[model samples]
Target: MADDETRVDAAEEKPAAPSDSDLFRQSEIAADYVEGLLDILDYDGDIDELVSAGRPVVEVVGGRLQALVGQRGATLEALQELTRLAVFRQTGTPSRLLLDVGGYRANRRKELAAVAKNAVEKVKEHGEAVRLEPMSAFERKCVHDVVNAISGVESESEGVEPSRRIVVRPAD
Candidate 1:
């Protein structure tokens, strides 16, 4: 009887996954926040709010939007965090919101894929670990995905934020 009660209590303590509707609501809130920001900045763009891959995604497509992307997508990352905060304020729950401006993330993903491949090649050739420059969490994930797909090499992140980087090593 005690074991049954404990099992029930543990199940109640586990948080339920957000439904698709909830994810869509987060995207809508994020889109509204981004639209207001674009208006303030006097930037022209079309914002799309949707749920993709179990997460909320807000994409802004427009011309001359490099300013929003900033150096190495720094500005875009900041905007994404702010938008997530806005969604949290309204929904009282944290959101995994992906905000893309001018297709920066897609382009960067391609670039990171190439970089990861090159690092893997070096590791395989020399049989030594290759240390890559520091990158954001998104960038690191991109590299990890690429490296993980390939054989004879493995990847791991080292150090801390803004200084953390991927180290590709020969598979043992």
Candidate 2:
């Protein structure tokens, strides 16, 4: 029937999701961009490009990279945005490329997990909601993951970017 044919045509018109190869390519582009930055800054690092969790990831590992991380990873966040822009310029598509330098993200995630656990414990013991300090999207996600894995507690984010924070409460 014509209806079936029209339905098929509509489905075909939908934009296809980026394949794994496409994500990997984004990582490659981001890696190259980060490498150029390191070169310009006269910094030494080992860059690795890959696709992880359906997103591109560019990790730079090296010594004396504290400046790149900056205070509370502000510089690193800026670099990630710049690297994402570089990928967008080359591929004509926005990128969700995660850029990690000097194992900052990994270390931060561990610290956040501990913080989340503490928040959950406080919420459980007091049977009251506990508000945490404002955190970046990445940090909020890390805390959410830890809180979600533990029972008897729930977490939610409130407010806007650069000021958004998490609130952990006892499960109703």
TM-scores vs. true structure, each candidate:
0.93, 0.91
Which pairs clash in the backbone of model 1?
none
* Tens-digit per-residue lDDT, 60-162, candidate 1: 9999899999999999999999999999999999999999999999999999999999999899889999999999998999999999999889999999998
Question: What would the per-residue lDDT of candidate 2 be over residues 1-172, giving only the tens digit for each residue?
Answer: 9999999999889677799999999999999999999999999999999998999999999899999999999999999999999999999999989999999999999999999999998998999999999999899999999999999999999999989999999988
CA-lDDT, candidates in order: 0.95, 0.95
The TM-score leader among the candidates is 1
Q: Show the lowest summed lDDT stretch of 10 residues, model 2.
A: 9-18
| Deviating ranges (above 4 Å) for candidate 2 | 1-14
Q: What is the C-alpha RMSD of each candidate to the true structure, in Å?
A: 1.9, 2.5
